[model samples]
Target: MNINRLVWIIMHVAANIKNYKFSVIYLLLMLIVSCRRSTEIGAPVVNSSNAVLPAPTKQLSIVPVKIDTLVNHPVLERGVIGEWDSTDVLNPSVIKFKDKYFNYYSGFDGKLWRTGVAVSNDGISWQKFVGNPVLAPSISDWDTGYIAGNGTAIYFAQRIYYFYQGINDRGIANIGLAVSDDGFHFKKHPNPILATGPAGAWDSDSVGDPFVIEKGEALYLYYLGQDSVGVQRLGIAKSVDGLHWTRLSNNPVLDIGAGGSFDENGLGEPSIAYQPPYFYMFYTGRASDEIRNIGYAISTDGIHWKKISTTGLISNKLRSEWFSKVICDTTLIAVGGGKWAVWFGGGNLPVPAENLNGQIGMLILDLGQQRDMTSFDANSDWSRSLVKSTDVLLGSFEIEGDLGKRSTWLGPKAHLTLATTDHAGNSMAGKPIIVEGWAPAQFISSKTGQYEPLTISISINGKIAAKRTFVSDDMFRIEILWPEIAQLLDHTGFVEMDMSADRAIVPAQFGVSKDSRNLSFKVTRIYFH
Candidate 1:
């Protein structure tokens, strides 16, 4: 029975037995104490006076959340129309000018890959340029046989400079440059700008998949280089005028990972972004399984790198039917709000002639909230803070890392409660406010325990508004919708959303071992429409 009903019965008996009032009163007190203890058996106790309290409920927690890896569906597919790109389309490089977005991509016409242009207003639906094959192969030069695609474009000095990989009759790949006044039509340079390295060098085999970015006055070119051993790695080349170039001393800036690691076999297909004090490099890591996925690393300077993870960020599992085994040739452009749009090439293996085509795919990454909350360094401000009624102890968490960063372990009996203010900066009393977040069960002891559902409670002001439960296969991500909370709003003042999750616990030798569950959610990004 519930505590309320049980208390009522105890009180009724005590009133009728007035002669034994002292005995009845004593028994009632014991029962109430036992109930309270049972309810809080595995829960952590908080000492309000000793604990450092969280910020006021009106102050929204700025904790970062992971980006939805599956947000980008195939915006552009190949062979939807049987024209110049009748077979396959791949390697997309995008630039936004004014209101329109331009995509320079490589397409195969059953013979050789050639460069093409497509334009879009919303960056989703695309219309191909009528004059397709803006950059094609030359019959008598180094790029004689095929203009093998992977093109990187930058609008600089009032002109668009296009860099691509060109293959000769001997099947050797070299970096070539092309110039265009408008984004559609382009003229190729007479000779290869960067050829293969000398014998016994790391990049002696071939260098392709050029990614160019203007850092200050100089332009840095990052590309994939293969050695005589057939292992692919990444290398950097610098240029002043975006034409003449010099390779960095540490030729292969990033090599293959350790044996049995995700990038153990090779690392290639570099895409780089320079944001503030850090330069992020996202590349394709090939494993022994021959499956290719996207991985990332960060560098203070463009030459030396610290890998974010040994595994790939965008793996083969994220690939669609057209993208059976590989997802490489990444190109990233920042979309506002701490998010980036990544475009890459994806294709299947055991190549069937009818389905041998590769297509361009897109995925998004949010760098802002990618850090783990379980562990921290001396500089962390979150250590030893009280989250609602739960106590958080610093230096007491298990260490783990994901996406190239260390993950903080939420202890058993720990809970994260965060408040959010509406992004519209108005009352959401009548209108529905959508809520989404990831709440996966962490650190399960048994196989079945992994499927256990977690509870989510949403409160407004100081009163409970809505509650729900969800079980997710993706332990790293989940979403919840709350319409009931909307009905409770008054539509006058700012709405404060207080979100909390129960402590994640596992069985122990004596009783139960409990840990805090990381609760990261965002209210500003959710929209009703």
Candidate 2:
């Protein structure tokens, strides 16, 4: 297929979803309401029984943005980072390590395209790697056609393994593999491991954008699956060794709705991060029928998810005039502790700015502090003792090791409660319990500053469970009660306070619960007499 035809194919496939994820055979009986039938390259993809492709959405339209506004919002303030080279910096996925930052992006020069890798020490200043086009098209492999636009969901293990999309000679986009010892250099798979859906399926038209991650022994693949209608569906799969895979019930993890809403037209390019028990997925979606915006979703298990669409995370509110569609290739990096940042390729697709500098942009998300990410087992040495500041401590409190530690805090029923006093026996309100991964911390300033959600989770035996999440008038005292924890407690669990987030929180009355969202922060101290 020619480059222009390929581009149109993607544009067509995303807008029409009625038959997107079903089999071709099913399409034979249930035809699309509207298909923008054309022969840019040749005949369209036949449905099962060799029927014609589904009709495109009649109301489909592209509202291109002005080059200026979109580029300024992201981190590419220094320069367009080689964006002027025609290698559309789409599908921007970046990872940060101890010394340098690595960026993996799609090089879509209007036609033939594939994935590339770049590096930087400071998140802003970048240096493209020698192995620039790290994983380009190789017709000799299963990805026979010219390769282009792709997405990868990743996990940090002994090495980085990525599952991305590659098109074949027939214009079919399929998922393939690549592995890297360091973040920069990569080696592609000898074959296309995952391919287009069977003749009659939601993903039958073509498959693109594979988001990969690992949960313990099982490796999960989250990707965009499309049907002839062009509508996009979020699909998923599981693997044992990260190489071979087992297709789940051919079910979509998520899909876009139709007409006039956030994510109404379609959803594209999924970026995900495991903030402990909860997995947060961020992707691009159309809003108000014309504009594209960022949508958010959270999941405890990668399979089941809850989407929050009432309000989008990013908006044209600040730079409305310069930003048209205003979205693409969202790449988020959590710089250890509790700081978070997101970057993406932005600019007017057909329109160029003054310097033609309309390029990459970043969304700075500073997640105050991080919480403890450890799962506790209350069996080894379960000891609970609170230190009632023998001396009024400021900034730091001191409790010695000889303060009587116990291996068993009264069987399976172990409870850890804490209440703080400031030299005088009184309640203290409005203390900060710093946290992570979440944005717009729940704080109320009208009443001496209040913290809304004080959720914490604990592990019992081998199972993880929630411990506490309640309100406290004495925010300083941080009233914590765990009678149930005291009753079924063991000695394996340890007492620690939250530290990832940098808020001035009272750790004395802190506790844990079975909420997955508690992954980004940690506990440091407990206050008890």
Candidate 3:
């Protein structure tokens, strides 16, 4: 047979290989044949048949991404020395209106915070409105202290509803509403829409940083609630007429992070976006060290939220001089193709809020789109890296860290996502995937004194890949040979191992330690062969 015909036959058979071992052999044969053809075609011939495959795409990896390269300065800078925003220009709430971007940001004039407007045609180059400080503190009203623009401006019913934070003379903060027919002009409501909770309530001290989005028939507002003890958390409220809001019965939907976590100190400045089946939140997380960064969370119903990780999604990796100290207060805009235009506040000084030399910056995030199984490239090979840790795209884990001697446990359900390889979006479909983890067989229930065995189910994307019941207290290895027809990772290049157990157990019940967490299993490592 001709060399070209032999190569064609090899490709045809290799594409249809079902068994992993046979598939590996065919892939090696193709590499050898390609090398020979390269020499014949006057191309550089790679003699070694063991050339390693490329790693995951650089775009998917976690690294220091630069700000808008076109203009490496703040998209919105502080005003002149005596202007309203002379001290700080931060906490931007941006929305696209009629093909233009309207940013409502908080401005500090060394004394008080006021709302200012900056218009942008491209969401990058911003021009401050001549009629600055569009919303200022009332002379003697409830907002006599300051008017914060660190809130949401949502367009609904041909009118823009701007929810903002207002402080009284006593330094108490509450959420207020303003109406705007034109994007620049506004009229304040008579009274505060969402007030502080009752004394000793979770939000008795303050409720600010409102992020409102309209769902089916009602509007959902996510905001930050601070208690009397200075503990801040995230909560949700519902509104029908954009003025009157009812806090969720189970308020403070999202709590602060665990001890030693990125958000251990507090959480605030929530900005939400919808990407179908999942609602994403980009909020500010303050660590115990007083360093702040942007954290991410996801939800299906927008009421119940699960944080993706203990680490911040957008950290101070760039180390830019202007934002060298902290990065917080996110405002997101979906700019198509899984790209989000995120405008946030950064500071060179370490102050958490108010005046810290705050400036506005922007970054673009490319979160891949979900694809169906029918569109998967069956011919692509998986990456050569066989071992992966929990650092990359892990979700619902009880805490963050490596699977070291000190156990890293997952909650009742967890997901491990694998990005497609760099080569033509290589996927893990029809590949031999293995996961090694440790799970306690049974745990004695503290309340009833009954033992509950671990029943775990693993899924790829949404398809059940493996399920097992562990009665013996032993380390387990789950190997699933995913069928080619099940193109699980085709969409979004993600392999979601939806691990669930019958029930989670606390280590304190086992006399293990003082730790109290609902843990299902310990995922040590994942391998693809």
Off by over 4 Å in 2: 1-87, 153-157, 182-184, 287-290, 320-323, 336-338, 350-358, 366-529
Q: Against the hidden reference, what TM-scores do the models get? A: 0.57, 0.55, 0.59
Each model's C-alpha lDDT? Answer: 0.55, 0.45, 0.63
lDDT of 2 by residue, 1-529 (tens): 2323322332343334223223442232111100000000122222222111111111111111111112243343322444322545555667644445667766544444556666765555557666656777785766655453365635455677766766555555667778888776677767656666666688776666666655444566676777766666786766666665555673676878556567776666677764332356777665544355677675534565667654456655544333445455566765322234566655443221112222455544433212222322212122231111211111122232332321111111222212222323243233322211121224311122655644444432223433344343222223323443343333212222222222223222233333222221222334332
Per-prediction count of colliding residue pairs?
14, 83, 1
Candidate 1: worst-modelled 10 consecutive residues by lDDT: 31-40
- Which tens-of-lDDT digit does each residue in 1-529 have in candidate 1? 2322322433343344300124442222111110000001122211112111111211122222233444234556676555666676777888765456788887776666678888876555678888887888888878775454567888877788998877666666678888888788788887777777777877665667788887545677887776655666777777667766777766677888999887786666677864322357887776777566677886544566778776677554555676667666677666533456666766775221113366666656655432222222323333432221111222123334433343443332222222123222233234454443345443332332444666657565445766666565232322334455444444212233445655344344314444233322211122332
Arrange candidates by lDDT, descending: 3, 1, 2
Order of quality (TM-score): 3, 1, 2
lDDT of 1 at 418: 22
Q: Comparing candidate 1 with candidate 3, which one achieves the higher TM-score?
A: 3
* Higher-TM-score candidate of 2 and 3: 3
